[model samples]
Target chain A: MAENKIEIRNLYKAFGKKKVLNGVDLDVKKGESLVVIGGSGTGKSVLIKCIQGLLIPDSGSIKIDGVETVETSENIHEKMGMLFQGAALFDSLSVWENVAFVPLGKGKMSKKDAKTEAIRVLRQVGLAPDVADLSPAELSGGMQKRVGLARAIITKPEIIFFDEPTTGLDPIMADVINDLIIESARGLGATTLTITHDMASARKIADRIAMLYHGKIIWIGTVKEMENSDNPYLQQFITGNAQGPIQVEV
Target chain B: MLKKTLGTFLQTLGKAPLAFIINLGYFTQFVAKSVYNCFMPPFYFRLFGMQFLNIGFYSLPVVGLTTLFAGMVIAIQTYSGISEYGAESVVASVVLISVTRELAPVLSALMVAGRIGAAMAAEIGTMRVTEQIDALITLSANPFRYLIAPRIWAAIIVMPLLVLFGDIIGIFGGYLVGVYKLDFNPANYITNTMDFMKSTDIIMGMVKAGVFGFIISVMGCYHGYRSKGGAQGVGEATTNAVVTASILILIANYLITELFFAR
Candidate 1:
C-alpha cells in the first residue's frame, strides 16, 4: 500500500475561450491527507474535478490506483466520495436519504436497514438520529455540512475529496467540521485531498500542504516548513498580505 | 476602412449560424442519449410510477375542464353558423369530429406543456445549479437513467390516455350544450355523434398527444439539464422550456394534421 493513490500528468482544461486549468500535475500517496491551499479561482477545484472525471482534461493523464482514468469510458466512481462546498444535498430528499444515497439507490440495502445505516453514519458525523427524517432544507449550514460529510463517508470510499469544507461557518463550527473531517478520513483510512484557502484548517488537517497559484502548484511542505519557507507567493498567501507577489484583481 | 468593416460584418454574419448549429448538435445528442437510456436495462419502475401519477393523474381536472368548455363553445358556434344554411342537424357531427381530431389532443397538450414542462424544468434546473446532479454522478448514479428517462417515458405513456379521456368529456360537453341549450332531441344528437365518430380520428389524436408529450419532456429536461450559473439561469430555463414546448406542439400539430388529412 506504499503506492501513489492518485497521479496526474500535465492536465489542461479550458471552457469556450477561457482557460480554467492551464497545466497541472499532482499526486497523492495512499492514506495521505494532502491539503491544497490557493486563492479563489486559481483552478484548485478544476484540478480536483479533473481527477474525479467530472471534467475531462484537454491533454493529460489521470491514474487512480495505477489505472489510467482519463479518456476512458469506464465507471470508476465507486472508489471515490466528495464533500462539495455548499454541501449540495438533494433538497427533495430527507437527511437519511441523502446520507444513504448510494446503498439505497443501488438496492444494496433494504429500506429499513438503509435508514438504520444512515442514522449510524449520521451519528458518526455528530448528527442525532432524529435528524434523519427531516429534509435537507430544514438543516442549518453546519448541520448540512455534517450530513454531506456523512454521505461522503457512508460509502467508505478509498479516496475522499473535500472542496472548501470550512468556508461558510463560524470559527467554532469550522473547527468542529475540520476535526470531524480528520476523524472520519482517519477512521476510513482513506487518501484525502482537500482544497481550501483556510490556513488554520489547513494546518490542523494536512500532513503535507501544497499551495496552488495561477493553475500550478508553487510550494509544498509540512506546516513547520511552510512557516519557515521564503517563497514570496507562499509567504504572502500565508500572511494574508495585500502587498505581495500575488495580486488580487479587485 | 471599408475592407475592415466588410470583414467584421462577414465574421458577425458567419458566427450566428455556427453557434446555432453547435447548439443544435448538442441538443440532438442530449435527445439521443436520453432516448437510448429510456430503453436500457436497470429501469427505474418506481420513479416512472411517481412521474405517471404527477404528469398524468394530477393533470386530469385541468384537461377535463378545458376540453369540456371547448366542446360547448364549438357546439354553440356551429349551430349559429349552420342554422343559417338550414343545416341545424349537422352540429352534432361537426362537434364530434372537431373535438376528437383537433381540440382535445392539442388543447390538453398545451395545458400540460404549461404545467408539467415548466415544473420539470424548474425542478431539474435547481438540481443542476445546486450541484445535486453532480453529486448523483459522483455517487455512481447516471442522471439520464435516474432523472431524464423516467420523466420522458411517463409523459409518452400517459399522454394518450389523458387525450382519450378528454375526447369523451369534450363529446359529452357538446351533447350537453346541444340538448339543453339548442333544444335538440337527445336521441338524435347521440345518433348523429355516433354516425360521425371514426376510429382514425381518435387514433390520430392519440398519436398527436404522444408526440406532444415527447416534445414537452425533451424541451424541459434539455433546458434544465444544461442550466448553469444560478437562480437567474434556472428562471431562464423554465421560461424557455414552456415557450419552446408550446411552439413545438403547435408545429407538430400542423404536421400531423397534414400527414393524415391533407389531400
Candidate 2:
C-alpha cells in the first residue's frame, strides 16, 4: 500500500443554504495521480479549492503530509502548484513574465535569469522560445493553456492540482494537454490531483479514480473497476445517462 | 392593515441603518488590512513604478488642462462681478486663493477618480473573476502586498505632485487672462497674486489631495476585490468606484476645509 500524501476527512462546505461539499472524504497516496470525476456543480472544483486552501471549508480537516491546513500558515501553498480552470494568465504580463511570476515576485532570481528559466520551461511545455514576449491576450486558447501549464510546473512543486485541465478546448488540443499532464507528472514524480468530468483525460492519466456525487466520493477504484463497476450512479455518470439517481437540476 | 403598514415601514427604516453600519465595519476592516500590508515587507517596486506611471504621469495633461481652464474662468467671472465696485484688481487675489486653496486639488482628484479609479476597479475585477488573484495566492504572494499596497502608495505619493502641477498651471492661466486678455499690468497682476499667496493655502490643498488619493484607490480596490458574478459584476464595480470616489472626494473636501479654516 502506498503512503497517503493527502488526507481529507469529513469536509463540509456550503454557500448560503446550498451545501456544496456535504461530507467529502478521500485520500491520494504518494506520487499517485488521482483524478476526481463529477457532474457539473457537483463540488469538484470546490473540493480542489478546499485542498488548495483557497476556500476555507465550513467544517473539515485537510492534511498534507499530516499537517492540518485550515487556519494554518500559508507555508502549505508553497509546496503546491495549481493550473486554474481558465488558465487565468495575467493579461498585463507577457507569456514569459506570467510563467516566471512566482520566482520574479519572490525575488528568487534576477529578471534576466527568470526570463531565461521561463523560456526553458515554456520550451519544455512544447512552446517555442519565440512566443516568450507576447502578452496573454495575444495567444490562442490552446497556447494560453500551454503557457499556464508552464507557469504551474515552473516551481517544480511536490504536489500539483489541475482544475478542469482540458476545459474549453478542441478534442485534439484536449488530448495534447492530457499527454503533457501525464508527461509532466511523470517527469516530476509529483502527486497530482486533477478534477474534471472529462473521462477520456481521466482514463488516460489517473492511477486511481474517485467519483464525487452529491459532494461525497461514492466510488473509488482503478479505471478498469470504474468501467466494470456495478454501482448505478457511477454507471449512469460514466454512460452519460439522462435518467439516473443523480438528478440534473435542469 | 394600518398596523401591518406601520410595522413594515418601521422595519424597512430600521434595516437601512443596520446595513450601513455592517458595511462600514467591513470596509474599515478591509482598509485596516490594506494599511497593515502597506508597511509589511516584500514590497513590489516594479508594480509601484507602473502604478506611478499610470496614476501620476499619465494624468498630468488632463489635470493641467482642467486647472488651467478653471483658473481662467475664475479670473473672468470674478473680474466681471467685482468690477462693478471698481475692484477688478481683486481678480488676481481671488484667482490665486481659489486655485491654490480649492479648485486645483479638488478638480484634479475628481479627474483621477474618473480615470485611474475606474481602470483599477475594472482591471482588478477582471483578475478576480478570472482567478488570477487566486493564482497569486497559490503562488504564496499576498494579493494586498503585490496588488493593493503599490496602488495605494502610488496614489498617495503622486497625488500631491499632480496637485502641485495643477496649481502652477492654474496660476499661469490666471496670469494669461489678467495680463493679455483683461488689460491688467503684468507686474501689478504678478505682485497682487504673490502678495496674496500663503504657504498654508498650498499645504492645505496638498493635504486634501493626499486624502482624496487614498480614498479613490481604496474604493477601487475594495469594490474590485469583492466583485463576483462575471463581466456585468466587473462593470458595476468600475462604475461604483468612480461614483463613490467622486462623492467621497467632495465630502472629504468639505471636512478638510473645515478642519483647516473653521473659526
Candidate 3:
C-alpha cells in the first residue's frame, strides 16, 4: 500500500457567487491520524466533502490508495467510511442495525452474524451490547457520538473521515469522544482525517495538525510545531482572540 | 475578460435547454425504473403495509369527507341546472357516473397527492439532507430500490383500492342527498347508481388511480432525491412534489379519459 491513503490536489468548488474550497490540497498518510483546524464556514467541511464525493469539486484530483477518486462509483464507496458532523445516524434504523449497515448489505452477511458483529463493534467503542437495541434518538449526545464512532469503524474501512466529531458535546464528553476516536483509529490501524475547530480535541487526537484558512492549509506540522509556530492565522485561531490577522466577517 | 464573459453567456444560452432536456429525461427514467423495481424481490411487505396505511388507509377520512361533499355538491348542482328541462331524474345518473368515473378519483387523487405526496417528499427530503441516502449508498444498499420502490409499489396497490372505497362512499353521499333533497325513491336511486356504473368504468377509474399513484410517488421521490441546500430545500421539495404531482395527475387524467372514452 502507498504511504498516502488520501491525496487531494488543488481542489476548487464554488456555490453560484460564493467561493468555497478554493485550491485546497491535503494528504493523509496510511494509518495516520491527521486533524485539520479552521474557523467555522472556512470550507473545512466542504474540503472533506469534496474528497468524499458528497460534493464534487469543480476541478481537482482526489485519490484514495492512489486510485483517482472521481470514482463515485459503487466500487469506491465500499472502501470508505465517514462520521458526519451531526452523526447522521438514520432515525429509521435501530442502533445495532445502523452500526452493522455496511456488513449486512455489502458483505451479504446473515442478520444473526451482523447483529453479533454490531455488538462487538459497539463494545469496542465503549458501548454496552444492550445499548444496541435503543434508537439513536434515545441516546445522549455523547452516547450518540460513540454510536457514530462504532458505525464509522464497523466496516474496517481503509480510510475514515470525521467531520467535526466533537462539535456539540460538553468539554468532558468532548474529551471522552476524543479518546474514543483515538482508540478506534488505533484499534483499526486506519487512516483517519478529522476536521475540527476544537484545539483541545485536535491536540489530543491529531498526530500532525494542519491549519486551513481561506481554503488553504497555511501551516502543517507536528503538535509541538503547532504550539511553537509563528504563523499568524494559526496563532489567531489557537489564541481565540478577536484582534489578529484572521478577520471574522460580521 | 469581456470576450470570455460573452462566450460564457453564449454557452449558457446553448446549455440551458440541454440541461432541461437532460433533467426531463432523467425524471422519466426515474419513473420508469421505479415502476420496474416495484415488483422485484425483497418485497419489503412490512414497509409496504405501513405506507399503504399512510397512502390509502390514513387518507380515508380526508378522501371520504372530500368525496362525500363533492358528490353532494355535484348532485345539488346537477339538480338545479337540468330541473328547467325536467331532466332532474338524470341527476342520479349524472352524479353517479361523475363521481365514479371522474370526480372521485381525480379529486381524491389531488387530495391524497397533497397529503401523501407531501409526506413522502418531506420524509425522503429529510433523509436526503441528513445523508441517510448517503448512508444507504455506503452500505451498498440501492436507495432507489429500498426507498422509492416500496413507496411506488404501495401507492400502485393501494390507490386503486382507495379509489374503489372512495367511489362507494361518494355514491352513498349522492344517494343521501338525492333521497332527502329531491325526494327520489332511495330504492330507485340505488338501482340508478348500479345501472350507471359499469365494469369498464370501474376498471378504467382504477387504471387511472394506478397511473396517478405512479406519478405522485415518482414526483415525490425525484424531488426528494434531488433536494439540496438544507431543511429549507427539503421544505421546498415537499411543496414542489405536491404541486407537480397534482398537475401531472390532472393532465394524465384527461389523457387517460380520452383514451378510454373518446368517440
Candidate 4:
C-alpha cells in the first residue's frame, strides 16, 4: 500500500455491554479515499469516533503515519479534520470564525488576516465571501454542509473525515456535495475516510469501499470490485434487496 | 402481576455503582484542572465581566428581596421571643448579627444557587450536548480556562459583594419593622444596631459567602460539564445542580456556625 498513512488493527469498541467495532482492521494509503459503508447502527460512526479520539476504543491499535494514537488522539488529531453528520457548527460564532477556527489558534495570523483567509477557504468550497459574515444557522442544509466542508479543509490537514456527508441532501445537492468532496480531497492531497450508505456517493467519491455489517467490516474493495463482487453481504447491501439473507424490520 | 414485578426488579438490578464512580472521577478531574488553570496564564477579564453580569448583577434583585423578607421575619420573631424576657431592646442587635453573620450569606447563596447555579448548569449542559465544548477544545482554547474559570472567578468575586448588598437591605428591612411596625424608639434601634455589630461578623459572612460561591460554581460546572443526552438531560442537570447546591449550603451553614459560635 502507498506507505499506509492511516492503519487500524484489531480495533474494538463497545457501549455498555454491547460490543461494537469487533476487530475492525483497515488502512488508507497516502492521498487515497477510503469510504466505509454500512446500514445504520453498524458502528460506522463509532469507528470514526474512535479514529478521531472522540470515543475511546476498548482494544485496538490506530496508527497515523506509523505512530500509535490510542493514547494521544487529541494530539494526533491536530493534523486531522472532521465534517460531522449534523455539520455541528458553533451557533455562537459567525461563519468566518468557524472556518478560521484553527488558524485563529496558531497566533501566527491576525484577526484581519484570519478573516481574509477564511473568505479564501470559503470561496474554494464555492461559498461567497458575504456568506462568511453570516452564521451557520442562516444557511440551508446543503449550504451548512458546504460550510462544514470548507471548515474541514481550511486547515489543510493530512487527513479529513466526513460523517455521512450526503445524508440529507436532494439528489442534485448530493451530487454537488459529492463533487465538492472529491475536489476538496484531491486539491489538498489529503487522505479521506468517509462513512455513508449513499450508493451514488460511494460510486462518485470512494476509491475503495468497505461495508460494515453486524459491527464488523465485512467487505472492502475498489469501486470496480464493489460492482462485481460475488459476496452475498455486498450484493444484498448494494442492491438493497429484501430477500437475500437480510431481514427487514416491519 | 408476576411479569410486572419481575420487570421492575430487573430494571433496578441493572444500575450498578460504576456509573456514579465514573461521574465522580470526572468531577474530581474537572475540579483539579480548573484549579490548575485558574493559576495559569492567559486570564480573560472580559469574560469575567460578562459572568459578573450574569451571576452577580442579574441575581441581585432576588437576593435583595429574599434577604429583606428574611430580616423582617427575624426582627418580628426576635421581638416576640425576647418579649418573654422583657428584652425587646435586644431585637436590633440580634437582627444585625444574625443577618450579617449567618442569614444574609447563607440565604443569599441558596437564592443565587437556585437562580444562577441552575441556569449555568442548563446553559453549559446544553453546550456539552451540542458539541460547543468540543468545538472550543478543538480550537486550542482550554475549556476550563475559557468556560469554567470565568464563572468560578466571577462567583468568588461577586458573591461577597452580593452578601454585603443583601446585608444592608436586610438590615433596612429590619429597620422598617422595628421603627414603624413595633414603635421601638428609632434612635435606640439605630444605636442598638451600631453598638452591637462587630467587624468580625461582617468579615466572617463575607468569607463564608466566598466559600459558598466556590461550591456553587464547582457543583454547577461539574454537573453541566459532564452532561449527556439531549434537551432532557440538560434540564435534569439544572435541577440536580440546584437541589444539591441548596442542600450543601444548608449543611455548610451549620458547620460554619458551629465553627464560629460554638465556643
**TM-score of each candidate's B chain against the true B chain:** 0.96, 0.94, 0.92, 0.91
Error of 3 at B37 (Å): 6.5
TM-score of candidate 4's chain B against its reference?
Answer: 0.91
lDDT tens per residue, model 4, B52-104 = 99889889899999889989999999988765354445889888998999889
RMSD of each: 1.5, 2.0, 3.9, 3.2
Per-model C-alpha lDDT, please? 0.92, 0.93, 0.85, 0.87
TM-score of predicted structure 3: 0.88
- Highest lDDT among the candidates is held by which one? 2
**Candidate 2: Cα lDDT at B156:** 95
Candidate 1: which pairs clash? Answer: none
For model 2, how does the per-residue alpha-carbon lDDT over A24-75 read when each residue is reduced to its tens digit?
A: 9999999999999999999999999989888989998999988898757658
What is the iRMS for every candidate structure?
A: 0.7, 0.7, 1.6, 2.2
Worst 10 residues of 3 chain A by lDDT: A71-80
Q: What is candidate 1's lDDT per residue for A50-90, written digit by digit as tens?
A: 89888888898889988999655667899999999999999
- Evaluated at residue A137, the lDDT of candidate 1 is 93
Model 1 DockQ, alpha carbons vs. true complex: 0.86
Q: Write the per-residue lDDT of candidate 1 for residues B1-263, one digit (tens) a residue.
A: 99999999999999999999998999999999999999886798988999999999999999999999999999999988764453445888888889999999999999999999999999999999988998999999889999999999999989999999999999999999989998888998898888888999999999999999999999999999999889999999999999999999999999999988999
Evaluated at residue A43, the lDDT of candidate 3 is 90
Docking class of 2: high
> Per-residue lDDT for B1-263 in model 3, tens only?
99999999999898989899988998889877777777666566667778888898899998899889988898888888875454445877888788889988898899988998998999899989977887676555668778998899889888898888888888888888888988788888787777777888888888999999888888999899989879999999999999999999999999999988998
Q: What are the clashing pairs of model 4?
A: none
TM-score to true structure, per model: 0.97, 0.96, 0.88, 0.90
